[model samples]
Target chain A: MSSSTDTQGTGAYAPALESPRSPYRRGKPTRSNWELHGWLFMRMSGVLLLVMVFGHLWVNMVAGEGINQVDWSFVAGKWSSPFWQTWDLIMLWLAQLHGTNGVRTIINDYAERDATRFWLKMALYTATLVVLVLGTLVIFTFDPCMDPASTLEVCRTGSAG
Target chain B: MATSLTPTAKDGPKRPVGTLYRGREGMWSWVAHRISGVAIFFFLFVHVLDTATVRISPEAYDAVIGQYKNPVMGVGELGLVGAVVFHALNGIRIILVDFWSKGTQHQRKLFWGVVVLFTLMMVPFAIRHLTFVFGH
Candidate 1:
């Protein structure tokens, strides 16, 4: 090691010099935009979610009777419409993916041990899969008239097929 | 003999190092964003499950949703909305920081703007929502 003055507060040891002929030990870089796309997706989906979530809160909680208005009938009424069905389907997908990715980043940051990080991420993926599939199915296969005693106009009049 | 690079008592100031982000507005907002995001994510799982109860029966769905209408859960709902609002507002701030030309320079102002707006919106919402919950 060469004798040198330390500028930053460490001892007088100078920086290590490397041989120009030293072979690069790092593995080849796999060209990918996965992380970049994930970053962009967060920003784009976040903007969309800000609008959609506000609309959702306005419709469900801020309008009419607020939380009291939420019930099975309310769900049936909203899903009965093709527009809300589509709205919710998109929301389900976007929100689930956004939330999953956000949590994955947090897991990466906090879970120091490799095994812990892997298991935690595995659990997160499993739960996300279940919620996404179940939520989508619920929206698609919803039988608004499933209840024989349903008071909905379509259900009561037997117009629903 | 191995030489260590650790600084001695005569090296410099005795103050501790690191924590570059401590006590800064940017740091606090980042912390809040992470926290609120995690909270919202966990809530989403429960929300999806509750909504899925619709597929079971109307009676089943109402039975569960009924729990949220009470005064206690009503207040909890207010907090949840508050968290959502904060997260959403700060998220926009983060976007501006990334995209806007002067965003980094005025980030502190933007954070205060987020705080003010959050308060302005939440006040009316809390009043209206509480009225709905309690007046009924």
Candidate 2:
């Protein structure tokens, strides 16, 4: 339906495009609704991140003596419990994935050239994988009593410390 | 034949004057959200790396983290708190804009609400955190 209006050159009134709600399927759903799912995940994960991140900030930067209290012993005290371990593990995964997707969107928008876009995303994904793995391992394998000269309560007991 | 969409002075009145979203609260909030999100993401990478130092040795971890207690990094932490606060609040606004039926209609008002909430939360945090950082 190339009407006269549709044939206008630059600096002319735009032609009306097809409605997004149109029933006609455009070449079988290719990406398998990945974009839709990503959109939903951003919202869902965003809400969770707000809570976890705020709690983290409060505990580490606002409570007690604040940042000064955050030392190896402080970390040992927190991670010694399974609860904080789980809290941190989930927080790590959610925050990383959420941030990665957001950066991926930015890369797609600004990196006009295909090679630039591809390499940017490649770097992002690589960093994401590394961070996730390292964070996870740290949470799981953390041994508060690893140091023989440690004097933490848990370390003194020769336990989680 | 107009081969390029770029409007030139030759086009006269046909050239667009300004963007539709420029100078609007919604636009500003959107810009702030993007900037904050990017800043937070980069910080997250550094945070993870620094935290991994715990696995090395307590002295190493303590030495590295001690840098944050310095005045320079203390101010940097304040800035980071500002970014995280804005991104978190604005993200909730975006969630409402997407899910609530009347969200788009009130998006401007919601952005202002985000600003107000950010200010409220940050004031105490700044006072408390700065005290801890500088008190000792």
Candidate 3:
């Protein structure tokens, strides 16, 4: 509001190229390595999530007959296989934990009060725990025939259980 | 550095005015990365809840997933794919910048590279995906 200079057009664009100086570079910084671990984990899990998520989408929604073919039995059949179960379980864990950590970073950066940060992260962790438990149970405990109301033909004979 | 900053500072009234996109490509890329990250995060949140229907009866589970087949939801699925692709691609770019010595120097170039790659991957994939959803 104080000025009218249009340096954007008048001067050559000088891109900010240098990386920010590390906090540890200053005098006697007592640094814990937790953030370093988190940073590395993001990259590693990102690589894995890309593969698992894409493959999950491909197999469940894209390959074979695609979405219309996805029924209760389709899911039951998938969970019945240990490989697919593990695939889904890993994907669920990686996505949830990675996302939770990402939001945690945001919360820490912006939340001004200790109580606000504490409560927000507590809520986030609770939701993440609930989802993780639910996803894990769905992947592992799934039994199509065991569901009493299943109308799928595979469940008719009760042998699919 | 202290002496150099003094001459660059214009008088109070003549100072630089705010403009759109004052930040460079890396900052904009960071903004996009967070937006896409949160999109994918919330999608997974809802998706996990939806998948929990598997614990319910088959009738109940089918009732939930059946809506996803609608063309309306197909459009949402496309948006989901867009978020996922951008997040993943930019996630890689960030990884490079963090761990590679040369990556920080070429961060802007890396961002444009990601945008081009995203276009290449999305266009054909989206066309084919939509054909399946609405073609029937």
| C-alpha lDDT of all candidate models, in order | 0.89, 0.88, 0.82
**Which regions of candidate 2 deviate over 4 angstroms?**
A1-30, A149-153, A158-161, B1-20
lDDT of 3 at A58: 82
**What are the interface RMSDs of all the models?**
0.9, 0.8, 1.5
TM-score of the A chain in candidate 1: the value is 0.78
RMSD to native for every prediction?
A: 11.3, 10.4, 14.0
Chain B alone, model 1: TM-score? 0.85
lDDT of 2 at A4: 53
Where model 1 places Cα greater than 4 Å from the true spot, the runs are A1-29, A158-161, B1-21
Where is the poorest 10-residue window by lDDT in model 1 chain A? A1-10
Which residue pairs in candidate 1 collide? none
Q: Please give, for residues A71-142, the per-residue lDDT of candidate 1 as tens digits.
A: 888888898899999999998899999999999999999999999999999999999999999999999999
Clashing pairs in 2: A154-A161
lDDT, model 3, position B66: 84
Model 3 docking grade: acceptable
Model 3 stretches with alpha carbons more than 4 Å out: A1-31, A147-161, B1-22
Candidate 2 lDDT, A52-143, residue by residue in tens: 99999998988898989998888888987898999999999999999999999999989999999999999999999999999999999888
- The C-alpha TM-scores of every prediction are 0.83, 0.84, 0.79
Residue-level lDDT for A32 in candidate 3: 80
What DockQ results for candidate 3?
0.40
Q: What is the interface RMSD of candidate 1, in Å?
A: 0.9
